[model samples]
Structures are given as structure tokens and as C-alpha cells.
Target: DTRKVAVFVGSLRKDSFNRQLARALERLGEDRLEFDHVEIGGLPFYDQDFDEDYPAEGVALKQQVRAADAVLFVTPEYNRSVPGVLKNAIDLASRPYGDSAFAGLPAAVIGASPGAIGTAMAQQHLRNILSYLDMAVLPQPEAYLQFKDGLIDDEGRVTNQDTREFLEDFVDGFVEWIDRQRG
Candidate 1:
């Protein structure tokens, strides 16, 4: 069966680079993987009391995360960590204590930033949470892209050849890693 990959775009902006990264991954993996692009925009902050009824949206988000075999986190750095909305969504899915939707899933995180360090620091911080959730993160082919002015065209297609090559390697690595974990 084709591996199911639910990609989470951490930025909600119309032209977020992270969204572009998610799109690029989808384009490359066209047939080999099933991609579910989940949105975090409408999820209200997670609260214990709300678990009773568990609004349809919250339940749907959890189902989406749980149903996927793996995840691709395309995130943006905000104040040296992932954006608040992204974190909120994760917390929402990791609900009811010890029943996290992401538990035992394989995942790869890649980030691009307009600033220098690319999102290295932010990714590390995210690791701490993912670790606690027991996620199996791919260790190789780490992607942290820095500012690349005009590297992507008006259509949001990545145009930098070097970055393009890196992305190719990254996707291949992720597929291989997913196979290994599945096996």
C-alpha cells in the first residue's frame, strides 16, 4: 500500500514558505505517497472540558493525524520556535493524556526561514515535544533552509537549483526511512 503522509503547514499566511515546501513535497511524491494536507487554522485551543463532546473539527483533526502512517512538518520559525498555531494543533491531538494521535508514528520535519539559522533552533525545540510524544523522527537528511530571496517564483515554485537538489534528496530519504520503519 502507498504510505499515507499527512503534511502539516505551520504557517497560515497565503504565501508562507512553509506552505510552499509542503506543496513541493506533494508534487514530488505525487503517486508514491498519499498526501493529506491538514489545516490548523480553525482549531480552537485545546481544553480538557471540551473533550466530552469533542467538536467535529477537533475529532476530525485527531482522526486525520491518527490515520496517517507518517507526517511531514513544514514549519516556520517564530521567536526561535515553531509558530503558536502549530504547537496548539499538536497539543490538541495529543489529548486525554497518553492517547496521542501521533504516538509511534514516523515523521520528518523541515523548515525554511527568511532569517539565517533557517529554523535549526526551532526544530530542536520541536524535537523535545516530539520525543515526549514517542515519534520516530528520521535522523538523516536534515533540512533547514535559510533566506533565499527570489529563489521561488511568483507561482511559489522553488527555483533554486541547489535547494531543489536538496529537496529531492530529502524526499527520497524520507520515503526510504518510512519503508524501513514500516518493515
Candidate 2:
């Protein structure tokens, strides 16, 4: 069975490494997973004042997430944590108390960075948030990839054999994770 994944790329940069990583995953999992790239860059800062009447963009974000069979967070580390835009998007989707879009959704987190440690700290922070939001996050085979130039090409192809194999393993794990969650 095929599952639809709402993919959230944490960075706004047009050619961000994390986005490339997300695209690579999309390519790897194309047979079993359909990826929908959720737009978070245009969302306004989440506000409780608007909880009763959320902004249209925020509502759309929540709807997209709610429609997905699973969620994938591809993030970049900034200041040793998740980027502000991603946090804002999460807050928007999980607002208004009992109406969270993320609750009980199967999820996975992965990231790539030029730094040695990759996006470990940021992924940790994001996992904490996902737990709080009640997502069933995958716990094994954590991916904190150290991205080099041309590791993933513009067409979302993994250039190196080892990197491709690792990502394939991650994708397989994610597909199993989703099945376990929904089974």
C-alpha cells in the first residue's frame, strides 16, 4: 500500500542541503510513498490570539498535515536547534488545544549538514517536540547525515553509493514504521 507523507523542509533557502535531503528521500521511497511538500515558509508566526480564528495559511498547513498518512521532518541545525520557521509551522499545526493536526501521526526525522555532527541537535529538539505533539516517531536508525557538495544532485539523486545505500535503509525503515503505526 502507498502512503502519503507531508514533507516539511525546515530551511527556506532555495538550494538548502536539508531540502536536497528531503528530495533524495522522495526519490528513494517513490515506490511506496507519495510525498507532498508542505509549504511552511509563508506562514505567519503562530499566535494564541488567533487560535479562535487562525490565519488562512495556518489553517491550510494544519489541513495538509491532517490529510497526510505520515509526516517527515527534514531540518537544518541553527544555533544548535531547529530553525525558527519549522518551529513556527509546528506550533501552527498543533494549536487550539484538542485540535492538533499531528496527534497520533507516524513520523520520522532526518537531516543533513556540511558540519561533522550534521543536524543532530536540531533533530533531537524536533523529536522532543514531535513527542509532545503525540506523534509516533521512529526511534531507530537515526539519520544525521554529513552532507558534502554534490552528495545529492539537483534532481534528487544520491551521487555516492554508500550514501545511497544508507538512505535506502532509512526509507525502508520509515515504510515499516508507517505500516506498524497504521496496521
Candidate 3:
């Protein structure tokens, strides 16, 4: 069976390492899953007033997530918390009080940072929000990419052999987790 997944790349930068990680995950899951990613940079700041007519992008994002079986978040640490853009997207999906797009979704969070902690603090911050959103997050084999020079090549693809292998396994785990949650 095939499942669709909405991949959220939490960084706005073109050269973001987190985005690179998301791309790698997509490659690993290409054979078994449908990977659909939504861009967050153009989303306006979350506003309750707009709930009546959500922005075009927000509506599209919600629709994509609602159609998917799971979500994958690849984010970066910004001042020890999830980036505002990412959080904004989450808030957009979690709207209309009871009709959140993220409701009961089997989700996973993976963070990357140039810092030594590798976005640990930011991932924790996201976990808190996902808790209230009722998303089932994968708990093991956590991926925290550190500042390893040349791990990402000039083309921004993951270039390190060891990290690539680990990500392959991680993608498998994510797919299995999604299946279990659906089962």
C-alpha cells in the first residue's frame, strides 16, 4: 500500500541544511510513499480573523496535510525555539477550533543546526506544540545534524556517506511508523 506524506521544510533559506535533510528523506521514501512538500515562507503571520477565508497558501497547505497520512518536519533552531515561520504554518493548519489539519496525524520532527546541539532545543519546542495538536511523533533514532563540514556538498545534497546511510534507515523507520499508526 502507498501513503501520502506532507513534508514541511521549516527553514526559509535556499541553502538551509534542514531543507537538504528533507530532500534526502524524500529520496529515501520515494519508492514507498508519496512525498508532498509545502512552502512556508510566503504564509502570512497567523491571524484568527482570517479563519473565514484562509489565505490561498494556507488553504492549500491544510488540504495537502489532510490528504496525507503523515507529516515530516525538517527544521532549524532559531534562538532555542522553532522558527516563527514553521510555527505559523502549524497554527494555520490547526484552525477552526475542531478541524485542525494536523489532528491525530502520525508525525515526525527532525532538526538540523550548525550549532553543536543540532537544534535540540528547537525540536523540544516543537514537541510541546505537537503534544497539544495530538500528533504522534516518532520517539527514537532522533536525527540532529551538527556542523560537519562537507557533509552537505556544494549542490546542497547530503554528501557524507555515513549520514546518508543513517537517513535511509530513518526514512524506513518513518514509513513503518506511519503504517503502524494507520493500522
Which residue segments of model 3 deviate by more than 4 Å? 154-157
Residue-by-residue lDDT tens digits, candidate 3, 101-183: 99899988897787889999999889899979999998877888785766766554668878888887788888899999999
How much lDDT does each candidate structure score? 0.86, 0.94, 0.85
Q: Of the pair 1 and 2, which is ahead by TM-score?
A: 2
Colliding residue pairs in candidate 3: none
Tell me each candidate's TM-score: 0.93, 0.98, 0.92
Model 1 / residue 90 / CA error / Å: 0.0
- TM-score, model 2 to reference: 0.98
The runs of at least 3 residues in candidate 2 whose Cα sits more than 4 Å from the true structure, single-residue gaps closed, are none
Model 2 lDDT at residue 61? 89
Provide the global lDDT of candidate 3 against the true structure: 0.85
Candidate 2 C-alpha error for residue 96, in Å: 0.7
In terms of lDDT, the best-performing candidate is: 2
Ranking by lDDT: 2, 1, 3
Quickly count the clashes in candidate 2.
0
